[model samples]
Target: MGIHIIKMPDLGEGIAEVEVVEWRVKPGDTVKEDQVLADVMTDKATVEIPSPVNGTVIALGGEIGESLAVGAELIRLEVAGSGNQNGKTATPATATATAGTTLPGSPVSTVCERAEELEEAPAPVAKAAPAQAPLLKAAPPRARGLAAPAVRQRALELGIALEFLEGSGPEGRITHADLDAQLLRRVKVAPSGPKPSDPTDAERTIAVTGMRRKIAQKMQEAKRRIPHFTYVEEVDVTELEALRAHLNGQHGNQRGRITLLPLLMRAIVLSLKQFPQANARFNDESGIVTQYDAVHIGVATQTAAGLMVPVVRNAHKHDLWSSALEVARLAEAARAGKAVRDELSGSTITITSLGALGGIVTTPVINHPEVAIIGVNKMVERPMIRDGAIVARKMMNLSSSFDHRVIDGMVAAQFVQTIRAYLETPATLFID
Candidate 1:
């Protein structure tokens, strides 16, 4: 019956204008309310903006790789209900159930208010005017990869220009690794940080773009907006390792590569069964804590593109092998860039791992809404003193970070300990 304007919502901190990476709908296409219509690339994350109003698309603001400010008119829509009078636009205050389905609005974006605060403050003076001279090539928005904001700022500090370099990231954004490789050309050793190079001076350029960039933004919002606390415990995965090996040997690599992941996941699910209080999300605006009945554990995998936390949706629905199968499928899809839109989001809880790169311990960011994250590290063969004798054992560290506003310190510690019990005993996972 009438047309409506959907403005771009702010993505996150320090995010200015985002480049329209791709538009999902064209003019005259009917879209459902809350259906994703475009992918916007910020300095931090690739945001999928949904249609707020169910209607027919009338016009898209721009084509791919075009930048638009937050609050800009992104899409015009023609709704199905309400009468138009005097040739003016009109829409039903109440949605028509027959035409389209609208999901409840997701938690008030934690980043929106923060972005408003930043905008209301004083503006900075112009640093310098653009160069009129020619010959310097500028890389289009698509050329760079997934470096974090910190990494990009570091690159700028080192006097490295982003436009010249080739990106090894998803959608071709420059990454910290690409920068490190350049630095490697100059120095024998690489320094350390998120951007490689430890206690050294050689530097290079890194551009932040795509999902990994988004991961950084979400983590920041989680850290700032949500009150979080950590609870850590040393888990003896010795028995769990034997069980995993036996299962893998029986199934072999083709059927599925049995690893501690499924065992840990199974244990995590069972513990959630016991302690339902731990399985919850904090609603910041409503001042309520929402607990979930299903276990949708998000596994945090780091690909060459960036860190992706794909959910094993309804993880509790599957058996041990089925759980393994689902985990493998999601992980493989993520690494291959075959992950569907929904496959990457809507997690109730999460687990993050650094594979062989993980050290003795590291605190991971709590995936927002999910309230908690389980972090896994490298298995080290170390000397263990038991029964008055020292013996070598392969052991790994598990660290869990929780939103303190929802879960208290003691409950979190106990939750990890409960999971440790199943992992340490191993048979507890199989026993009814």
Candidate 2:
């Protein structure tokens, strides 16, 4: 048997390095061609590295969360016959299988290529620990219960043994409900009698890695570089809400339901026409601000992994229904970790909202390179004096932050006021 090496492919767009997020195989594990070997995180998205040839994994080039430079050795494998390694390395032409998005220049092909094109010489291979013998065979034990793949994965994550629990599913299959019941039983049988006044302090040290690490770094850099100024304004959205409800009632069956986000998006798009400065990207290092006529709105979405801002390209071209549909699709993709690199980048401005959790006021941080970010707060009805009557009005606060160096206080206020007027009227949003 001879050795074969896979190097990190050049995932274009000037990506110099990537972080190792996960490994699918270990030493001695047999992997097939096109099988994913590891997951690496770029600045935009996570990409998968797949095996080009069937082989046994022999060594991993980096540890979890380790940053690897482009063209560096990623993994080594042992194969039958005369393998590619002979004081030199055999590099796969296409080393990446992007998880959900394709890299700009890296195409998925089956052709094998030599490593001579990559100028960097191969790094010394670190010795790998001997693979441990399997404690159990491939088949499950007789006492082990039948469970779906998802259930089995969840059980592994919870550190619960399948053989210890009785199943509640059809044909004695273990379901998630069974695992929940087991957990409830354990909680009920715990020691209840209080013996001491003090309780044990427990803590978990979680490594900031993967998406979370990238988010932390980006936020830190934005806050450090940009001098941010916040502007808060209350908007009367009673008419806007009524209009949205009316439209949803009229077209709920014919078309998809509409949410307040689409209306707000419309207002933002229209408002940007008067204030182009708000819809621009600032390069502080170059001291240049580039304005765009096309409105690309980045909708900040919270996912299980972390905060991800998926962009809605050319928002000005879509109406309420189309905007709502696009927003829903992008949000779903982001939450499911399926959004592509193009959907995740190139936003001229950003919009963030917490829905019901949005407080009365928030000092939102400006998305880096973008001059402004508009934050939406929860809507509430309060008693107000309109003309001579004390009536109820739905009020919502818009908390927006702008780069003080680029946009002055008066301009930012005017920009927010423009959005407020469009939202309050609910008809001017369609005029232009």
Candidate 3:
């Protein structure tokens, strides 16, 4: 028998630490090789960490929501074999100063070296077995369902049909709110419980941790470092609307249809040809600015987790339909919490919209390091003065922000004017 200490694996480049979101296996649980032990969330994505070897878990490294540094001790395990319990052939490993002794198992030795430098520790001796605690049985047969144990128990006590109730949680997992809603719909009352005597107007506090903390830090950093200059312009998108309707009608039968965002994105790319500063990144610390040849458009999307900006690579390379499809794919992936690291960064410019909920013009913040961000406002039909008369025209405002250090007022206005021209004319967008 041998004891092995598992260290947190390197997640990715530039990732120093990760937060433990959930632990799948408990101490004393027998886990198999490659079985998921926990889900750790980094700034980029939530990744599942799998067990490196088949072993009984002795201890977890940290509690939930605790941050663990890369290469830190993650978990301790007791295994039945000498070579990581896999019985795989071991390879010779060079002894390091951190370890006075080296094991034939290269993988285990490498892991231990990274975990910590123990001072002349000898091999672990097998200990006598201890009395096992009483295992808790699962809920009654009638309480069995796809919901969590607590939700299942509540539903069973309330005589709710799990099969009939629709889940509102991620991946169709039933949430307590879903059960409550179901109960309310049927009986117009919450689950039978004692009523509170009175409600007090007390302060409620929410911990500023997790994604919210990250967002606050990033936003503060951006605002503190970048000198923001906002520009607002109203465009007559009447013709653009017509063109969009025509394109959607033609492509409506397909799996992905055209939307105003794709059209606007293409127009933005074309407009960048006139003013490339807006489609560039500025490093204030190094006093360097980089302008990219290809336009990687970042679509600012709001998800249940928080605001996520998923980039659509090579926006200039794709046609209108292709860009629309890619945008749809990236947006869906971002909202579903499946966006990859590449898709979440490296955007030359960003576009934000509230869809139909877009109110009047907004002063958008420049995405940090990126020189500019384009904000799309809701389209509404309003009275506008035409050549000879006041007419009803579909109009929308483009609220854009720029890093004043890189983009000037005249240059920013001209860039937006170019976008407006393409949107108003609709035919200019096809001009190579």
Candidate 4:
């Protein structure tokens, strides 16, 4: 018998550390290769780490709910027929992972899955209520997912139909919310729950550890150190939206949904080319400005944990459609907590958009050292005087926050105007 020490694998690039969100297997528990050992929290992702070598766990290096740095020893296992049970033997890392595997008990994946299920489910419209009755009744027993005694009792108390809400929790169990919603819909409830707890006075305990700390540190540094100047431009996106609709019609649906952000990315790249000074880093080492030609645009995506920025390398090369797809893919991966270190690191500039939650204008903090950030707001149809006549046009605000130390206000304004022009006129997007 031999025991192998399992140090935490590097979750991804730029991610020097991670928090132990959960430990799936305890000491003395047998784990198979590729079986999940724990869920870890990183700056860019919340990942499920699998076992590199299979064995019975002997000792783990962390306390439950403590944060452990990446590459820290996480587990020690006793494998049959190796060396000493004292865990002096090295682990056998024979398998390599090309794609990320989901970890068990991840709340982020569960939330995403729930959102998709709701979206795919037939919308609960009052008009279609009668027509969908037969389908809802014929729904399979597997959909019910209540086969256990405790779950049955809870389901009955909530007045939940054993069927309707699908079980997503471990072993397909119906949960509290599922039952509550069903009960509420069937019967009315008198206001209970301690006569409405005062929200302003309520305090909840949250463990301030992991990426939350890192984010706080970064934001504090940015606000304290950098002198920021913001410039705004309202661009008419009617032409761009028209071009997008035309492209989607020609190339089919999957290839054509041109998100506003991609168009914004292209505009930023064009402006970056024109104003190369904006794509620069404030080198603390040399105390000088270092400029680069390659534009690495980081798209800020919000996850269940917090906000993470994942980079899209060389945004200049992608057109409207390709850039849209790339941003979408990166944002999805970022939200899923699957983004690696490299994806979250080395961003020259950042662009943040709230999708439909977008409002007209927002001030973005300079992603320190990078010199600039752009915030894209939602597009809305508004009346504008174009060519001496009032007409409705699709318009959105483009906001840029720049480091005033490196970029002058005039230069920042020009750069923002240039991007607005490129977006307002789609032909300039592909032009040299």
User: Best TM-score goes to which candidate?
Assistant: 2
Predicted candidate 2 versus true structure: per-residue lDDT over 19-85, tens digit per residue: 7889999877999999999998887487888999999887787667666768877988888866778
Better of 2 and 4 by lDDT: 2
Off by over 4 Å in 1: 1-19, 22-207
TM-score of each model, paired residue for residue:
0.58, 0.74, 0.72, 0.68
Order of the predicted models by lDDT, top scorer first:
2, 3, 4, 1
On TM-score, who's better, 1 or 3?
Answer: 3
Residue range 64-159, candidate 3, lDDT tens digits: 655666886677777876634343432111112124556655767777775665445666788866689577798664322467664676577679
Ranking by TM-score: 2, 3, 4, 1
Question: After superposition, which runs of candidate 4 have C-alpha atoms over 4 Å from their true positions?
Answer: 9-16, 46-48, 69-71, 82-202
Higher-scoring candidate on TM-score, 3 or 4: 3
Sliding window of 10 residues with minimal summed lDDT for model 3: 89-98
Give the clash total for candidate 1: 15
TM-score winner, 2 or 3: 2
Candidate with top lDDT is: 2
Estimate, for each residue in 208-262, the C-alpha lDDT of model 4 and write its tens digit.
4456745765686687778898888898999999987787788746675776677
